[model samples]
Target: MANTTTTTPNAAQDTLVLIGRALIAYLFIPAGIGKLMGFAGTVGYINSVGLPLPEVGAAIAILVELVLGIALLVGFKTRWTAIAMAIFTVAAALFFHKYWSAPDAMKMMQQINFNKNIAIAGGLLALSAFGPGRFSIDKK
Candidate 1:
């Protein structure tokens, strides 16, 4: 073949971003299902944490994650869904994982999980502003 080169500054970023969104959506699906099914133990934990309207909050969170995860998976209204999810994730990290001055193991675990969520939320924030790549319903 003749010499050929095809690359763009945004191409890799777009591909990685799409993959990241897909993975996040995939993980959320099961978690959402757990919440949707009223996993009694989980709801109990939420209540124990003193979340206001704990049951209702759990339900809403389930629906938001499930529905928005689906939407994000298909890249439909990608930006909006990403932004909404970003907000939810950040809130969850703050509310549930804000362990300070705890045992080192627990604190480290919480910090890792919390930071992971925040990083994902950051990706979502970028997605919300950038819109999905050419491979999305937002494009169609």
Candidate 2:
């Protein structure tokens, strides 16, 4: 018989989970860091949206994005972090993106952002269901 090597499904899944974690974290972490560094800008933008307590909202956003993004990146508390991020993404899409009411000139951009958030939320939900995989802090 000829010798052959085959990769296990679990190994493939583990690599995919790691890649997913890194990609999502890449999307969130820089934005979080930028928000933290430009606190005044984030606060001003939040206030412009007419949401109450812009400072509080900005702080909450910074914490959730940075902390949860890091947790997802390192595969720590995977399911819980993913769930939290998913909820956060949905809320942000509704409250901030609101493409349905945008003016015609900006409507398409806002709609794109809103849809992107929803897509990201779906990915997060999937990550929560599948978890961080074997090469993670939550590994068995």
- lDDT: which candidate is best? 2
lDDT of 2 by residue, 40-103 (tens): 9999999999999999998889877898899999999999999999999999999999889999
Per-prediction TM-score to the true structure, in the order listed: 0.83, 0.92
Q: Of the candidates shown, which would achieve the greatest TM-score relative to the real structure?
A: 2
Worst 10 residues of 2 by lDDT: 2-11
In model 2, which runs have C-alpha deviations exceeding 4 angstroms?
1-9
Residue-level lDDT for 91 in candidate 2: 92
Q: Candidate 1, residues 13-90: lDDT per residue as tens digits?
A: 778767877888887877888788866766787887789887787876887689988888889999889989999999
Q: CA lDDT, every prediction?
A: 0.82, 0.92
- lDDT: worst 10-residue window of model 1: 6-15
- Give the Å error, residue 27, model 1: 2.2
The true-versus-predicted C-alpha distance at residue 13 of model 1, in Å, is 5.7
What is the Cα-based lDDT of residue 35 in candidate 1? 81
Sequence-dependent TM-score of model 2: 0.92
Q: CA lDDT of 129 in candidate 2? A: 86
